[model samples]
Target: MSFDVICLIAEWAPAVGACRESRGADFYWDAPENPNGEDLPFAIERARRGFDFIEAGFYYEILRRRLPSRVRGKADSFFGSVYHELGPGCPEPPDDLADDVGIELAKHEMYYSMRPTTVRSVLEHARAVPWPEIEHAATSAVMPPRITRHDVRDIEHFRSIVWFHQDWLDEAARTGRGLIVLISQ
Candidate 1:
């Protein structure tokens, strides 16, 4: 199965919580029915500002290995699993919420997980690594075979995905918004 990494603004916690009340994908797209409940438009705009990177597992693995935990600041050195939080203070979303966003563990090998991190943490981690360094390291990193649904073999393609992630983090820094990291399989 393919892994999709989706980033959403941390401000949408309430909206997310509302939607997650009903498990499965159906609730995620449609806003909750209560008109005065939450600011749907604002949440949507924040989501629009977020990033979605498909099949980036390989590059994630590469960065996870090269980026030392010491410099990760409050951000995770890598993505997380079902049993672990993404990082120290980054707590995993509730089980029902994870299911709603397609991150919950399933019998068909499908799994989804999410963690919230502060804007400062994201900025610290993003600024810690320069773009040129990321590009060079990602391009030169060795990837394990058969680890992902689609393993990226081309260096340019690998660099592009890594760049996309960095750019998203940069945008979050510029906007001064906390981030939610969602990993769906």
Candidate 2:
């Protein structure tokens, strides 16, 4: 049986189109300018169109899946505080609720600030941990210092182009055959 794979391309509208043209594979391009572009809908209409899905932010998925629960909890608290602060002419929270919310928001802020570094650390941990059970038993297996160092270096390189490089965008502008869709999750 042939497997259908969904590729989510964030900020790489042109390359995604090129790939769809060349490989006949589905493409989804989420970019800043066209947050709700028509690429996905058009692709669906075309007979040979392989592009299937569209989403605004791919980082959110990584953040949701790979980030630790502690970090997520902190983020939630931060959001709650923001909601409270910007309420619709509502009364202030009780002292207990305010204190709890304040602590949670602070913790969340800390986690938000350290997200990049935390991501790097988590990726390092993944590489060091053995297959099948990275969290349970394999995390304790000590890796060489060089391994951690090298992974961090690689992560830095990846951070540079997590979105499509500039050249890809220029190429897309040159070719106006396909659409680039963006959907905010």
Candidate 3:
């Protein structure tokens, strides 16, 4: 089955110890009340600042923008999963924003960070590539089982469709909890 990314926001400090025995999608320290589904905000633009698999990549670009120029380039060259999973007692997102801005993963995929490099690539490709080019390209070559390909509209949607909030993402990054992306497909 094709996979989709969802932000699995935890309510309490995640029980990472409990996650040790779980694998793949089970990597989560603890499951939220709902795992396969979560809510979406009502206001479109405000919702845009929250999580949706479609536009979250754009938010990652925003994070990449904050990095120092030199580090940004260096970080660009190194590509692997940039995940910030919860440690034993990972900090939780602000109660006010958490539910309004998180996702529940599909059974087949797990989460990771989209990071700047990936985000940059998405933005650039959106500007330059057409759907055919995407098919010819080894999109997401590094993350094989995952998707690297997107259509012209897909890129537009990424640029405009997803929602993100720097405060929430910043909290996640600062606390070593990262912008969630689905991986391990």
Best by lDDT: 1
**Residue-by-residue lDDT tens digits, candidate 2, 1-185:** 11122222222344334444533222333422346764543332211111111110122222324435554443323222212232222222122211222232222111111112222332343233222321222234332244322232222232333223122223323433222222212
lDDT against the true structure, each candidate: 0.44, 0.27, 0.32
Worst 10 residues of 2 by lDDT: 47-56
The residue ranges of model 2 lying beyond 4 angstroms of the native Cα positions read 1-61, 64-155, 163-166, 177-185
lDDT of 3 by residue, 1-185 (tens): 33344443332223222232343235442344455544311111112212344233433343344444454344333211222221222221222222322543342343433333333433342333233332222233222132444421233343333223333343444444324333332
Q: For residues 90-145, write the lDDT of model 1, one tens digit per residue.
A: 33323433543554534222233233344445345544544454455566677667
* Number of clashing pairs per prediction, in order: 2, 4, 9
Residue 56, model 2: lDDT of: 9
Question: Candidate 3: misplaced stretches above 4 Å?
Answer: 10-15, 27-108, 111-150, 153-156, 161-168, 174-176, 183-185
Clashing pairs in 2: 26-50, 26-51, 27-51, 56-183
lDDT (Cα) of model 2 = 0.27
The best candidate by TM-score is 1
Which pairs of residues clash in candidate 1, taking residues 3 or more apart in a chain or in different chains?
103-112, 104-112
